[model samples]
Target: MADVQSLLDKGSNNGGCQFIGIWGMGGLGKTTFAKALFNKLRFTYEGSCFLTNVREKSKKHGLDALRKELVWSLLGDKESHIGNAIYPYTMSRLGRKKVFVVLDDVNDHEQIENLVGRHEFGSGSKILITTRDRQVFAGIKVVDIYVLEALNPNESFDLLSIKAFKNDYDDMKIRKLANELTQYADGNPLALKVLGSFLNGKNQEAWKSQLDKLQKLPCREVNDILRLSFEGLDEEEKNIVLHVACFFNYYYDAEDVKKLLDACGYSTEIGLTRLEDKALLDIDGGKICMHSLIKQMGKQIVREESLKYPTWCNIFWIFKKSSEILKKNMGSIEGMIMNLSEVEETRVIIKAFRSMPNLKFLRVYGNLNVQLRNKLNASGMMFLSRNLMLLDWVGCPLKTLPTTFKVENLVEINMRYSKLTKLWDGEQNLVNLSKINLSGSEDLIELPNFSKAIHLAEVDLICCRKLQNVHPSILSLHSLHCLLLIDCKALTSLTSNTHLKSLGKLSLAGCSGLSEFSVTSEKQLFLWVCDATINGELCSSSGHLSKINLVRLQRCEGVTSLHKLVDMRTLGSLDADYCNKLASNLCSKFDEMRALHFLRLTNCSELYEVPDNISLLASLRQLDLSGSNIETLPLSIKHLSSLRSLTLNGCKRLLSLPQLPPSISLLHVNDCLSLETLHLPLMTEDREGDEFSPEKFSLINCMKLDGQSIKAVEASVLLAINNNKAIYFWAKWNIREKELQSGSCIGLHSLS
Candidate 1:
């Protein structure tokens, strides 16, 4: 349901500020949305960042590199961060000039922060981000959020008509076929667009048969249908994608995945060019993506081929062949790690690195206490002591690094899951570290000086229970992003007043004894941020609340109802599990919110009854009335026309249900079996609280209702009468405990 004519018109450049988000599910016009938005603003920008797949970029190029790329591009791809004297040099080059950036389908909170951030843009600057996650701009004030809901019935028909018959067919025949195709496409325009164009001149029965087959196939079976173009690939071109997936990093330069395949005697440079022409794959950053959907199909074919020929695959003996390439290229090796490697892969890997005597960085599948087997009387450290830049043994037990190496060139040493109980005892200017993950270091207490790693971008000390110091030295690395201290138990006061403007994802999930959060970063998500504090403290007045649980807020003494929460409309789900004092009456007032879908009000003990006006919410879909003292349903509950599921489980005191509207397609009433009376209406009774309204009720299940209670009943109702079942009898007696003197329910999980 969409109007394309108004889409570009609603995009804004008003008030010297513009916030545009291109939103949709995967493959449903997300990139198309970005391209459409770009055509609208092409004349306004001098430089543009057309970075595709923001998620894949960050995973490959570290976050700093991505940010620097943007800045560099704005200044004609020159210097990244200008020195104090050259700061004005870079700004003067870019100032008063508008640069439009389009980060296509960016999927992370941190990527958005790095891409645009809160710093005000210059007068003519506009930053546009396309994302599948609407919450990307949740906390920030977006000038316009163009939500790409599916096409309207007429629009869907028009789009397909243009694609299929292209104004050549009879109007009646075209409309009829388009309507049937629309039902299978389910309003997803991409599928409609693709299938419509493909099936245009086909016979009617052929189209119908395809739709019927599609309906039976599960989601996993949809890969080929989505990427049927890949099946035309010759055996040679088929191996290109398989070679890339197994070992290529995010930006898998075609030349790179090619070298591995070339070594395997499957050299297919001409074949690759042919596949790209067919659109089965595209060159992204000089690497192959095989198209997002096509890649899925290739993966399936690879899996099937792998199982059929166990020793070989799309690339013959991929791992063994890869080991040969790495071994042959070892003369120029700088650093490497092959942790947890299997025996078969290990031997091939060993042969590959055998030539790298000049290697500086190294780690592989071997016990920490074992000495080198080859170079007799030499320590493992001595074997690797030249020109090392970085060393990472992610989940290995390493007691020491190469002490004889020139440690002065060392920048980063990731011993995250290692057994190193002490920091490397070095006094050299450790100038280049930007990230260190000591997440599982059991005995680590303190860290190296901040003066050393002045460029650190992230530091993770998660699960280091003995962590007590806040590490004043951390103030030096002004560019840190992810500061994960999830299970640090002994942390009491977390204070950071540095230039932590770059920080994004912060998780403090299970730190029980921790109390105060003095950290000032761009964004933070607290899993449990309150105090069982030895001093009983609470969180800041209001942190950037995105997705949060109940413990994030301590005693609800100061908080009233959520009125300003309407601005947080991007919120999709909320869990207020233990907030025993919060009332459902206060929560129900959020009916004006159009995007609020999921509400979990599980343990609000004092939440005795749900408001009768809850049906006023046109957007309410998944409602969990579980674990409350709610006794009855209002006839007015039939107004919620969009609700697909109604869960009344564990609302133990619920004795009856409102004759639910037909919009409820999924019903979970396992705990509602105790309800003595389950009366469902056949039509809408929401307008007048008198009888069946006969407009909106399309309920699926109501075993305890009389034929009179269900007005306008259809004849196909299936009735069950088992030996132990007596619905009418229990329907009368289940209302006795409704007047019990129950205590106020605390920690209600209501997501109003």
Candidate 2:
């Protein structure tokens, strides 16, 4: 505690902006220290936020959700709408407010940028970052970087005694055993606690036996001490722990693990909880987050099962061992995950897979380079195991499945970006199949009859450029929930069946050859028809199908307008970027879209002026008009009370902009070479509502715009640029006379 307080004192004491980094190896209690400091300093700030398990949570739910959570935590606003670009909203809301924030377990620099960009927070704000890798702190100005050390012998003994015997150390025998255990722990607190608790209730003879084994094989490393905890787990719990370490720890979600284990007759609910209680795994934001040391210990246990017989282990993860086993034909493995994306290409015989008779789950991942280079000759081994259930091979370079392979018990097949023209030569009974994801299979030309796949729920064929025909039996599947045919350039037609009552989303974007479509179902929530040259009128013949929440029709060369959306009251997002042929006059009809929250018209080089009534979209949050030919914006834009982001990038011919609402926090006006006049609202106490300055302002490449126009807008912005020495603002700017023009003066859009 004294060490923590002493380090805190070394930070910037005047409440100026500062960043403190705490870095150390796994299990050194970096998170624990950060949490303690957060609790101690939280009350001193106007607002505070603590983001825990940032690395793990970013994988499961994505960084956008985390940004929303951060907004709610710091600003205490439950209804804050966070867009895809989250930094602007965070800066707009929290920039001027003194706050304390702690980002825990950050692994990537991109994560740091998206969460907390070049810190422009309030003067007294403090940001703390904690990570296992010291290199992650590079390029950031940190006031102090404290590396946590292992506990002392006495402290380790006390922690062990508390967890093991509830602090009751009066008995000499117990005290002696505890002291010996602490020494084996070697000042690592996690090892001491786990080992001490494993031998808590055992008799002295049992302790003696355990100690004898420990003496024979001394616990010299932290992972070795963690191995003892594994020894105490039952067979079922051990399997669960091993599975997590091998597979789930990397990317698999907890629900997927639960389903897989439950199918294997293991009580996954109880086993997972037991593992968590034993400190083998932790559940963060509903995902498995195992400590790095625990995962290492689990992998070590599997490798030790038979160092000479690695294939005898229940799971395989290491690329070297799996590759060696396959190359040397030394042994057969149970299940494996092979990712050769970042490695050099290597050719292997298909018989390598045939040797693994017990293989049930196999996942092969590759990059474009591997797909083009690696070869897997299957002429010698044409038969696949009948026990295979899940086969996911991304970037596979095969024309078809093995002739002898059967698909009776296959539950899922994901072969994205494969070079296959057909999945199979003949019809096969896919009785248990639930999903088929052949997305990005550019050369795929056909799909087998899915009539026998009664349980099939989804079929994705996105970007299958050569796929001209889809199986007619698809319309017969009543249980199908999603059918994604996005960018199937060669597909000319599709028939929508009314039996697909559960169909939720249908994407046909970029299918330039598609001219016919039939829609008979009404359950679709998302419809993306961008870049398609559809033959028929959209929703003109079909009765009003009104349940859609999103419609993307960008670059649909044949469609001139969204005249068919007269009844789509539920539409909230519309992205028509680069839709060259979209009629510009239809912008007047957008007033009917009162529920829209996001509207993007980027790169629509043909669209002219925006409709004056566009401000009728009262609930709109984001409005983008980048790369459009629009000449002027409606002055009524100030009436959009809910607008947060307004992008007018590349509006080369735009003459002027009207008074923008203070509700907007992000503005982009780059490359507007012809934009001569500007109007910025001045900040004053009389300004209507809570005013927020633009967190981000870009004016790059506007060659004809005068720099003095920006100076006259906000004088403080010049001071801010000079004070912070912002590197991003160093390009050429033509400075004009320093005089405030009459009505074109810049106002509250200052760079803070």
> What digit string (tens of lDDT, one per residue) describes model 2 on residues 352-405?
466666666667775536453445533422555566667778887778786568
Q: Against the unseen true structure, what C-alpha lDDT does each candidate score?
A: 0.53, 0.68
| lDDT top scorer | 2
Candidate 2: the clashing residue pairs are 515-535, 555-579, 713-746
Candidate 1 lDDT over 662-724, as tens digits, reads 555455554444455455433343432212122112222233434444322321121111111
lDDT computed for candidate 1:
0.53
Error at 149, model 2, angstroms: 15
Worst 10 residues of 2 by lDDT: 724-733
Model 2, position 435, has a per-residue lDDT of 76
Superposed Cα RMSD, model 2: 19.6
Report the C-alpha displacement of residue 502, candidate 1, in angstroms: 5.9
* TM-score result, candidate 2: 0.57
